[model samples]
Target chain A: MEGCTIIEFILLVIAYFIGLILLGIYAHKRTKKTAQDYFLANRTFGPVILFFTLAATNFSAFTFLGFAGKAYDSGFGQYGIMAFGTAIMAVMFYVIGRKVWKLGKEKGYITPPELIGDRFNSTSLRLLFMGVMVVFTIPYLATQAIGAGMLIESVTGASIGWQIGAIFTMFVIMIYVIFGGMRGSGWTDVIQGVLMISALTLAVVFIAINLGGFEAANTMAYNASPELFTRPGGGDFFMPMMWFSFMLLWIFADPMFPQIFSRFYTAKDEKSLKQSMILYPIVVSFLFLCPVLIGIWAHGVGLDVSGQKDMVLPMMVANYAPGFVYAFVMVGALAALMSTADSQLLSLSTMLSHDLPFKKRKISEINIGRMLIVILSLFAILFVITSYNPREGIMGTLVKTTFSGLAVLCPTTIAALYWKRATKYGCIASILIGETSVFIFQYNILPTFGLLSAIWAIIIAIIVLIVVSYLTKAK
Target chain B: GLWWRQSEPLMFGLPFWVVYLLILTLITSVAFYLFSKYYW
Candidate 1:
């Protein structure tokens, strides 16, 4: 039976890859051989495709593994933070996303840096924006690879080790991304996004039934660890200040993520972007509840995932779920991570190829972008094998590092779009000060007053940007 | 905020705070829907 289950899992994984590759080939055929078509899918995504791609890209391994892990370690507040915070971010989707889409369509902007650089008319500012994006996004990207490796390792019982699993996942993602570009990534996101939501919903329902019911599961978990149901949760992680900090952080930071920022340029119309904004909160809020519930319920089932909280969901499925169900959920987890990684790779490639000051060469821009995808994927794989520390937990690392770092860019981006007097020097000073402050707060160089470092960094960045812009305004 | 620190008063198999947040999420969705239809 074990052998049979292993075979079934392997076959499912292979079939999933084949489907993705076929989709990539189809997208390649449809592709117009232009930089615009390759990077932004010719600016033709409708509401449904836009919504799925945006949600899938935004959620990532962080949603699948990290949410559950944090819920296990913290508590129910995890749901409030993500669901509510993301719902609020949808407002920005209209405020920032609409303007970005219009500007991108009008100005022929292909990357986030392009929009910023053109607005400021400064190559230095553009490169700095690109530099901050690439530096921060790589760690987040590495987390996806790490999540994929761990999922593979858990499902196969280490028959194929994490290193191989990580490399293999990156390799497959590279092929599809290079082949399909934006269209391929968008189309696959629709499929993977649906699969991830459905599989997780089913797995959670199945697990709840097995452990009695939703009520019983909650009761058992609460009885085992009552603190989990409250604010400040198990280790006092979500105190009032931190809760407020997170709520504010996601609003400013989420849309700043390079993959998500690049996605704004893909919307076919303002209506499509608006439709996505409406659906985002509803879908993401509900979907997030599934993993958080499962993570908390793992405690109900008496699974002790003390140090390795990220493994809670996988470990629970492995122990209680049928082999087929286990395989399906693992595939869903892979879908979650791969969807995000492919977009990240594509967005990074687009930014580098379009925004950088490359000498005129015979190679087409699309080809150069494709080569960067390969290089970036390999770099991510190397980071996963060499630097990723599993015990720190995905949510903790992201909130401390990626979320905070990218968030500092929000002030600069918003200023570029809305503030006409926003000089390049102002933008440059904001990013420099914002990132440096985040680093300081992260390493405990200064107290956060019980709030996340991001809040402080953003405040500092905003003040610096405003003050600097006023001082350097053109007469 | 301090009132939600206790684990009692489970509403529909979830803590009251969890239920409150879920309700808040539903409200947010409805609000966004209205925003999309009318305001946006």
Candidate 2:
């Protein structure tokens, strides 16, 4: 992977910034005055916009970079596990999104903590959920920062220092987010999201042409290793992982994950919510295939990316494609990176300002949101200098240990929503039991079963919440 | 595994560029129309 010209890199960055600045300014003017408007786009986002936002927002750096990397490294073995896990993630959205939207409307909830607090009718229970939320969120945020630095380095030939790159990336994002809220964030995501799709799609076409055709990728990936081609959950322990991935959706119970559920509360009504889910997965399935193609193509050609599997897209394009195609492809990779970074920075800052506060003291929620944008943007900056090396794939960073930790949250949330008898005591007991059990296994012991301890914790937690709430006559 | 990368010009009348953009458009159009009728 060589010869990314200085002129090409600068022009691309310039074009990107100009487009972003124009949108950010327009969105700033369009920005509404209320807290609800700032955080949730005043609940006015339509179908296409919300679908792109969810796809753009949820499909983080990990998908763009790490998925390719893992495919390069482990090939089909990783694909089956990750692909199935991700598809299940979408299904979870359908089942949980409707319920969360319904409850959110009735309760007027703002963050995940709000759901927990309202459901248990207790401050402490909400606090427990909040703690888990913050801890898990940091790593996810760090993954974005790590991605930002890599994008700059790849295009610029590392001419810019890590500190300088971090500043520029964060500064552009913070200004728009601070001024415009979801209006700015949403609009920018549209731009970046489009760029992302264009870029990845371009790379796929280029590689597909070079490698022969669409079938070549899968054929090569399989002939290289036949065992890897099967569906992910079709194996011995596949059900457990599928169940683990499926159950992880209880995060819908958390109100602060503004990327998706915020759409629910602000949605014009239940119809938009239902419709988005029905069609959203089709887009996901289509977009999902592109990078996998690039990975398999790279594999066939012997484009060895070593440890940093995440760099497969950039490396393949740079090493193999025509210069024009290379420039265009970089846009998609950067698009994925920026789409995720911009929205997340906005969400993270909002949660800190709005959710962290004990009470809404007369502070203009919009200004406070902007202020937190600047503060949290610094975290990405810190991650750049320290995150010079690729840590792991996107699945590693985004999913991580939290997938299991979420199991505990799931049982209580289900019991709360579907079962009226679920008590506050039951919620607390479930979270404590489930999360502790996950920690024990993640750190102390490897599970005899591949599914791990989180599932077990969730099972026990559900039993406890049900039995206790029934016995105590829960409120 | 043996097929040539250059053989296929477009996967379904749209090249990768056209295909992904089409996917994006189809989703947005359907969702936007529905959203307008229902929420907007």
Which of the numbered candidates is closest to the native, going by highest TM-score?
A: 1
lDDT, residue A107, candidate 2: 68
Q: Write the per-residue lDDT of candidate 2 for residues A76-183, one digit (tens) a residue.
A: 334333443343344444455667767776766655566767776787887786676656665566667667667777767888754566567667777767776777
The CA lDDT at A412 in model 1 is 90
lDDT of 1 at B30: 85
What lDDT score belongs to each candidate, Candidate 1 first? 0.89, 0.63
lDDT agreement of model 2 with the native: 0.63
User: What TM-scores do the predictions have?
Assistant: 0.97, 0.82
Candidate 1 residue A363 Cα shift, in angstroms, is 0.6
Please list the residue runs of candidate 1 whose C-alpha ends up more than 4 Å from where it truly belongs after superposition: A1-4
What is model 1's C-alpha RMSD? 1.6
